[model samples]
Target: MDFPVLWCVLAFVAINMIGIYDVVHLKDLLPPLSMINAIAAAYLLDKYKLPNGLVALGIGVIFFPSMTAPIANLKILLGSAEPPIIYGKAPYVNPPEGDRKALGRWIKEHTSITDMVLVHSFGTQVQVYSERLSPTIYFNITQTPIAKARFYHDLRQNKPAMILIPMFPEYQNLVDADLRSFVSDLVKSNYHLESIMYNYQVFRINK
Candidate 1:
């Protein structure tokens, strides 16, 4: 076997081992197994004997997204900067803009230090800017069966004061039916729509 392909195979096994450990221990995968997998795939593609054109195409596919920041920076230097498009494979030209800081400030003013908030999408930003406790930190409900159950359990146990659902331009929030049903049921039973911010909805738990 080609050395890089062999390396990729070894890396794949190592990553799976770590992943299994994380699942068994109810722990988050450190450094993200996806990143490790991506690196391994890149190495394999780089070393695998293939048509010159195909190799070039594969490398370009990997290289382009990583260049977004540099390209944006160059645009800034030339005084032609567009609204800072975020970096990723399916790049959006200019996403719908909203003042999250203002929303955070509002949350801070309305909620107490002890109040736990649940935020989807921009959980870290809300946590940092709002300075409130959030049970949803680094936890994604759709990732695994354990995570999904854990999310519901935490919601039941903590009864967080607020839940924020931001409207994405791509409407990713609407994709998961299971999660949507859970949120809808929770809203119907224990929460009410408190306010709608520029690009998000805040729901308050009934006291």
Candidate 2:
């Protein structure tokens, strides 16, 4: 065995010592032996048979996080790979959680006698707040800019009592010069800056 093979074996032994056995039940001895054998094969083949990238990838696969591993396994295991890059994995936020009542009073005080309608990006979750306020909410597509334009144009011509800006990613192109100016002028003159919610701006247009 070469230096790399010896190093991987040492790492594996260390992993077992550090309590990585909770993950995938390391006690049977077969998996560790299999891993050692793979490393040995990789070492011997590194010279003449196996490609360098393949050997390195094999080592990474053995050393990295197993998807089936228990949650705290990383704390106990050595050389654990970082969590994978999975798309659509939404980031988390921690809050005191849903035991407050002042927000109810705030919404009631703001939307009094106004037929408010909230516009948001689809699936951004403004609808939850709109329930008690009796305001309608419209949503735009997350991908196409053209869809956003059609939405903005519709909103301007209809002139809803209120508008909610969610600051979503897909609408940047639609928030161009004309759109910005129109919304800005409305906010300054007739629209009142109601409140901010989860990075969004709520504005009430006084008709």
Candidate 3:
């Protein structure tokens, strides 16, 4: 009963279970799983006295399929691919439907520096690009009831010049249904759609 092997198996099972439950991103598990693979490989090599080249080849065979997308992406980045390859129902370098950078530039040009904006994306990409303040620090306000309340309060108090709502499928899961309904109603009542970036809807406060 090899303790190290048993421990590695337990760790692998636990990490996969956590990932299965949607507690963490699958990408986050890569590091630990890679470490486990290294340990297992070391053990196998010592036990079987396997040639180094054979072990390397075996590892490459096991992981090459997973590397295909990344390899394609590398080629795209290097300007070697002309049109880019489609893999797993998506293009290798598929940019999101909208140009976020262009949207940010539009915000920066049209809105006053003093104006605050409300964005519902995951990061500060909009803020950084727009050079405008966001009413609330929490980007994904639908994550908690308190955050939602704070966002509502901020929305009323700040009267932001624009509210950017993501329209992409990937963002659909991040938004709460109730919050979405509230925002839709609010936008209908108090805001007008100013611009439609393919991935986002920009609404301006009605004058």
Which candidate has the highest TM-score of all?
A: 3
The alpha-carbon lDDT assigned to residue 160 of candidate 1 equals 78
**lDDT score of residue 112 within candidate 1:** 91
Candidate 2 Cα deviation (angstroms), residue 170: 9.8
Q: Write the residue-wise lDDT of candidate 1 on 1-207 in tens digits.
A: 655456556655664543333353332333344456666766876788547678668768876767777987799799997664343224322123235666677899999999988776434455567788777533333444665677778777777798887555433643356766776788789889988665567899998
Counting clashing residue pairs in each candidate, in order, gives 0, 0, 0
Pitting candidate 1 against candidate 3, the one with the higher lDDT is: 3
Worst 10 residues of 2 by lDDT: 92-101
The whole-model C-alpha lDDT of candidate 1 against the native structure comes to 0.63
Question: Which prediction has more favorable TM-score, 1 or 2?
Answer: 1
- The weakest ten consecutive residues by lDDT in model 1 span 88-97
TM-score of model 3 (CA atoms): 0.63
Candidate 3: give the clashing pairs: none
**lDDT of each structure?**
0.63, 0.51, 0.67
Q: Which stretches of candidate 2 lie over 4 Å from their true place?
A: 1-114, 119-123, 132-138, 141-146, 166-181, 197-199
Best by lDDT: 3
For residue 26, what is the lDDT in candidate 1? Answer: 33
TM-score for each candidate, following the candidate numbering: 0.56, 0.36, 0.63
